[model samples]
Target: MTTFRESLARVASRRSFLAVSGLIATAMCRPALAQDAGTPSASGWAMTDGRGNTISLPTRPERVVAFSPVAAALWELGVRPVGVFGPFRQEDGSPDPQIGEVDLDAVVSIGDWEEFDLERLIALDPDLLVGLSLPDVPNTLWYVPEDASATVEAIVPTFGVTPSDRGHLGLIEDIESLAAALAADLDAPGIVATRNEFTAAEAELRDLLAEAEGLTALVISASPDEIYVANPSWFGDLRFFLAAGLPIIEPETEERWEILSWEQAAKYQADLILVDNRGGGVPFPVLDPIGTWQSLPAVQAGQVGPWHAVAPYGRRAFSNIVRELTEIIRQTDASVVA
Candidate 1:
């Protein structure tokens, strides 16, 4: 059995952006004739959002503005938005990578995660605004500031799909239901094929982990100042692995994450470590100055990898994530890590 670090080294050499794009294109190239691609002529439609609020639309929401991850999911469902509330341009002025391969050249930038351009959003005159929400925090938009929620919702009916509350499969199903109401083909061959692939990949992951009964992993967000260990209950991604029977060690403290001072991070050990990979996340190298971090076995052995904390919850994305982790587990040496 090879150590987790050695497995990762091999995995990195095999990753290919072009190959992934090809896969996504091949798996998700939706038909232009999709009903959801056209303006909805129906008089009205209704559905419940993440907040459990019944929202009635005068017609299918063709002109939409959504959070980045939600926007990506909508694209997979064959729906495009008028604007997205994420960085429109990267630092180099390229299209934001947050939305995956979705074309955003024509999509208005409502604003980034912290603040929204209320004037720009209103000018778009969107039919709907979408994002992730939690039932516990009703009325408030998840990433959007509370000060702007009322004004934003006033312009367009807001709907949210809470992934954390719904779990992985439920989240996909909810998005499917929303897409159906919007006239997207939930049974489209492309979508059906991706779903089938995701199911098979998930099963394979479970079987692979079953063979490594003692293998364990940890999810963390590291920064120059602190380390945050994710609790499975708080993250849909971590929860997915936990449900698959993977040994994901939870933080001892009874919160969504157990925060540790940078120097204290090495005390917790696991066979593998998944560090947050979003643009804002601090890279693993940031911990180099700390002796404790250097001593951590996972880090010393290079058993760390990027975790897409806010990946789109769609069939293709889920399938890819599961497959990647399955390969890592298969390559990892249980004895070395143990």
Candidate 2:
């Protein structure tokens, strides 16, 4: 694993963003268009963000920067960012799978999820900084360090959609709205086709769920020490499943997740167990040796599978997940112990 300072040094050495954005800043400096047409500027663009702020750019920002999932959404809509910050790089120094086909060669990382290189971000000279924002968190930039938020915002306009804010469709809609403002061709054939595909997949899942009545699911983030069960209220994807007529087992608590002892985890039996597949969680093969995890009905029944708790939240991503879950539900044995 690369250390923070080492990552910073790596980005500083590349000096890529400064060279890439020669056209972006120049567009920002261009004169505003006529008011006779009632538009701020022919190039000006604006949209209301998840944090309830209207972020406007003097010109349709050509140089955008974001994380992997966000980059995927933008790419699907025909816009590619100039930089992408993420949790880790692969052994070959590529961004992790969470980014999903983003052009790693084109974008630079500020650092890992919890850290940022302020000077390096300034070096990007980005016209806009896009990211995820949660609901009711006064701060709008997601995953950004609190100390660095203000400074980063001051340097370039920053805004993002809250993936947890609405249903799966709602989340994509927010991204679509933002993409439209950035001049994406929302009506493009490929983009429209993806949406249609999602609709069809969702309908198929709905029919499958109807036959799998009483089937239940649990989403967990597990580690060597403890288990974190997701609270449906806190995640749009989980909520989407809950709303789709599937009975998702909810954790007892107000927080987004409930921490449990391994023994306690075995107490709540579910027909399906969705393990968090993010970098920190324990893998299925590794968990199989653990006595507590193996004792669970779902685990013993081979009902465990990877859950993308943080990645692939776009239209196609959500569609794929729904279809996957539907297949799992179809094959699930609903008589499992609780």
State the C-alpha lDDT per candidate: 0.66, 0.66
- Each model's Cα RMSD: 9.6, 9.0
Write one digit per residue (lDDT tens) for candidate 2, span 1-338. 33323322332222321111100011011122221221247657665666656777777677777855777778778878888765546656755655666776777877765667777788988988877664444574655777888888888888766543345566677677777777777899999999999999889988888888678888876765567776766566666777777787888886655778777867567989987665533376556667999888898898887766655447877777788888888888987854
* Local accuracy of candidate 1 as per-residue lDDT tens digits, 39-61: 34564666667565767767777
User: Model 1's lDDT to the true fold?
Assistant: 0.66
Q: Which stretches of candidate 1 lie over 4 Å from their true place?
A: 1-43, 94-97, 280-282
Pairs that clash in candidate 2: none
Q: Estimate each model's TM-score.
A: 0.82, 0.82
C-alpha lDDT (0 to 100) for residue 86 of candidate 2: 57
lDDT of 2 at 174: 67
| Candidate 1 pairs with clashing backbones | 2-333
Worst 10 residues of 1 by lDDT: 18-27
